[model samples]
Target: MNSAPTNYKAARRDPHAVGTDSGKSTRGEVSLSSPDAMACLRRIAWLLFFTALTALGGVRPNSLQPPQQLIASYNDEQSATLRWEAVPGARLYRFQISEQRDFTTIRTDALLLPSKSWIRATIAGLEPGKMYWWRVQAIGNSGESAWSLPVRLSTNGEMVGVPVERLPADRSVLAFCSVLRFSWRACDGATSYRLQLSPSPTFDRQVIERESVEPYAEVVELVGGRGYYWRVQARRGSESGQWSPVQQFTLLSLANIADAAPSVKESQRLRLLKSDDPVPVELVPNPVADVLTVRTPPLHEGGSITLFDVVGRQMLRMPVAGVEQAQIPVGQLPAGSYTIVITTSQYQWVGTVEVLR
Candidate 1:
């Protein structure tokens, strides 16, 4: 009976049993399907996946760098120098100049050292009175940096000699109805000149004439017996640098021609009795066939008369007197409209006349 009891306890705690009272089992019989064990395995799997995602997020795709600094300085009136701070790992530096604010390839490019920090280059052939902009760009193996701020500079105009020596001499006056010949020494870099002639030394009224790159200009078709003043200025395209000292010249009297052509038959010619005074005028036989006649009140001595076409072309010039009548020849003139001008040294009278065939 005691042996049988022992057999029952042995069966309850068998070492090779599928399930045991002591909760100890063999490897194949172990209950690994418990909720707590399953939950622990899932947590391990999630940790491994999270670690892989974090490593990928931390890796940088590409590197980004900053732009370099630019500096510009003017060496002289016609020259400029450009410099820039060196950028580490830069392939090359591109320099650009532009007349406009926006940078473009149309502007001149000055290539600088790829890795060097300092570069000096002279900018020549620039126009005066013009503003220019410059900037630098840094290029590297990774990518190109942003462009630097633009630097602005202006060039000076061409220098001109002082006291413009080539100007016409003082008291050197030109005469009306005379071909005025003007010549002067060229300035150092002057390509051409702008010639202006007027009736006053101050150049209030200007007659413009342009000459070639040469230093001379011929002014013909001057109004006879009229006092005219003139001045000259130098130019290089839109740049009008400096004006010469105002030169004063009084147009010579029309009567001067009488000395040379005394043989020409002279009838009653119009003349201004006043040298530089205003006078009223009246015309008779204005539409006459053969002779045109004009009459004016007695005038001061030294007055003159001038005849011109509609286009201001001088046709005839004569002296004036306190005479009863002045006669003009119309036989040789073509049928058209003409202007009869009577002027004194200080006064002027203008009238229109029609010529009839």
Candidate 2:
């Protein structure tokens, strides 16, 4: 009795194209040449189609399946890795890890990994003797899913092999418009460095690996809106030293690039420490542009002082042993915040230092 709705889809016309309702035949017939003029009739046809299909029942939602078989890895010095069995129909996964059982002391942020096959995330800069925890969740076009049961991780063993520093200074987000330059500190007694990058922190998917002896490398093809984990190891003759810490960084698109320099958001969580642990030694010239002097207590006098860019890229390493206080040259360093981890036989402490040019 009435004209058809103007919402029906046409094979060629835009979905929202409007249709006229002024034409009608005495026999109650309608002629709709345009797509939108046949919405009601198309709906009736779809109803009949889906109705028949509905009689056959339906499939389960994709979000119902969760990632399983979660595993932790400690393959490199100062690093932790989480791997899990991929969930079917999952387009992305969220991986989180923390030192606290309550999830209040997380070190890494939610890592959104694309691909149903992505199943791992590796993080570096883990101090020895600390208990860590981690979990994962799957995401799809449907929605985010329930988080998996958390798991605890125990330290494997004391770090060994000559330590090389990873760069882009960990967690360094780059603009997609710029070429990504990966660098690390050169290791003594090493002939080359192996650089590895991946969409999944575990290097399970979309992996890129390269080898160089210059202590630095570059890449030109990482897309925006995804997290990447990278690491480096020094190779000498038949021996490869322990890998530098794993670093996670994001590449952003052009819209986010307001200025010539890419926008960088540095995330350095509060220094993780036990309640009764000794506070780290004081460092003079914290907002220091040049030289930095560390006043160490007797307990940490002989410990090593190491500085890392956020996301765990080591920037500087020096022995603070046999001295009341240690001073290191930072005259040529760029302006930014850095983390300092002081390690001795007894305990380890972390703090932050800022550099200004």
- Give me the candidate number with maximum lDDT: 2
Deviation of model 1 at 186, angstroms? 1.1
Please give, for residues 1-357, the per-residue lDDT of candidate 1 as tens digits. 111111111112122222234354332133444645534654575466345535655322123243444443444455555555666765445556678878642235433444344444445445557887877666545545677777775665545442254433334322244455555667654535777787777666656555545576777757756666666776543456677877654554666633422111244344443335354566667665545677876656676556666655555555656665666545435578876676554556666777888
- Cα-lDDT of candidate 2: 0.57
Question: What's the TM-score of every candidate structure?
Answer: 0.29, 0.30
Please identify model 1 stretches exceeding 4 Å from their true place: 1-158, 173-178, 259-357
Quote the lDDT for 12 in model 2. Answer: 19
The 0-to-1 C-alpha lDDT of every candidate, in the order given, reads: 0.53, 0.57
| lDDT string, candidate 2, 1-357, tens digits | 022232221121112111223244222134557544455555575467446535655323444566777755454435544567767655456565677877874444443444334355545445556777877777655555677888876554533255454445455444353456665566543546678899887888888988775667777667866778988887643346676667787665555443332112243223454335466567787789756777767544456666666555554555556566666555444678877776665656676788898
Candidate 2 local Cα displacement, residue 246, angstroms: 1.7
Cα deviation of 47 in candidate 2 (Å)? 99
